[model samples]
Target: MTRAPWMAVIGLVACAAPAERSLTADPGAETTPVRPTHPSGIWPVTPPGADSPDTPDPPGSATNCDPLHLVATDIDETLTTDNDEWDLQIDDPSYDPAMRPDANTLLQGYAARGYTIAYVTARWDFEMSDGRLASEHTVDWLHDHGFPLHGGLVFLAPEPDHDGDEVVEYKSGVLLGLQAEGWALDWAYGNAETDIEAFLLAGFPDDSTFLVGDRAGELEVPGIPNEDAYTAHLAHLASVPDVRCE
Candidate 1:
């Protein structure tokens, strides 16, 4: 697939309150064991240039960018059930994480059908615990568990101050950045009410958005049971024509 020309402008909105937002909670907000440095792995280290923030365009003028059909999903509860009651296990060493049931099947199915996958999580790029960048471990975790990595990219929150409710805006900006880079967000999945807010704020259609776990009904978006949503999503993708970015 041909890379779309990068637009000079991107649009972003201010953060909204939790109740007003579509998605909720920070996936990496909970405490976990911190490694002092990233573990070496076969996957190439994500370069620093890739972590730069996209410039936002003036209000009301942000353009819909990119021709690639993309599926953007959250990492914590939406894809991995590897967390505790509070849902924060990505940084833990003892989590013994496994992909949420059919997540692999669903994502791999999308890849096979030519859809690009985007893992958009609130996990910060800078580590708070040991001062190491978390992106490497995050990628290793995905690769270690066999999640589809070939045609996908991981979007991590660039800041360490996730204590505020900026997650809604942060996630929204990531989607908007992708749009600025010329990628069209076709589908999005998340467990928090804020996920719905971010996706909608970024202009995803209501029917194209899916909420996982119990928070699905909190917003007007359609709900898919956590256990079976992936399998069902794969079935839905069968009808979608393949789109390539390379």
Candidate 2:
């Protein structure tokens, strides 16, 4: 994989946390604390108390010690249909878009075989009116809609209304950070040219990149067209080897 420069990955993580970072959750709001980064610049967002802090990650969960398989995916259009409801979702924290057919099921199959899911989106880090960060809404949506969450992560843009180039940069930065921290990103899913660019920039092979929704069949992008909401892809995924720890 084309890894980002170590300094670039460090810079990206530093930018994610502003000078005035707050470790405490907002009063009375369900929140995940954005912890200080480990030396490698990747921080876990899996709710702290969900599993014992000292306990090692189970087989299917992501752990840096083992070079496990990981699947990186986009949120809008790739996983959900007509997800332009971000503004509405911010105003009404309960608003959710319809999930693409079989998207969750396909990812679950990968997770079952020990692949960690990395939800990389261009959504801004703005706080909703309900006091939850946009990332919180994303997590809730995934859980409410039955997506796999075996130690998965949700990566968001540092700012709002990202253009295509900005989206590519941010998403690529997230992938690079994961790569630096020892995750083997074997496959990637998306629905935009930006997603294609990001995945390729992060060194994913064209055959391993799948694009859904309107841009799926575009001839210019370097990704396999997944027009059937991953229904057909599930069978192919079954044949890939599972992760084996050293």
Could you tally the backbone clashes for each prediction? 13, 0
Kindly report the root-mean-square deviation of model 2 from the true structure over all alpha carbons. Answer: 5.5
- Worst lDDT 10-window in candidate 1: 2-11
lDDT of 2 at 199: 93
- How well does each candidate superpose onto the true structure, as a TM-score? 0.66, 0.79
Q: Candidate 1 on 116-171: residue-level lDDT in tens?
A: 67777777644425343456556656766667664366666655566435778877
Look at candidate 2 and give me any clashing residue pairs. none
Q: Write the per-residue lDDT of candidate 2 for residues 83-110, one digit (tens) a residue.
A: 6766567768877777877789988887
> Which predicted model would earn the best lDDT?
2
- Give residue 158's error in model 1 in angstroms: 2.2
Identify the runs in model 2 with alpha carbons over 4 angstroms from their true place. Answer: 1-11, 14-34, 38-49, 59-61, 219-227, 244-246
Question: Which one wins on TM-score?
Answer: 2
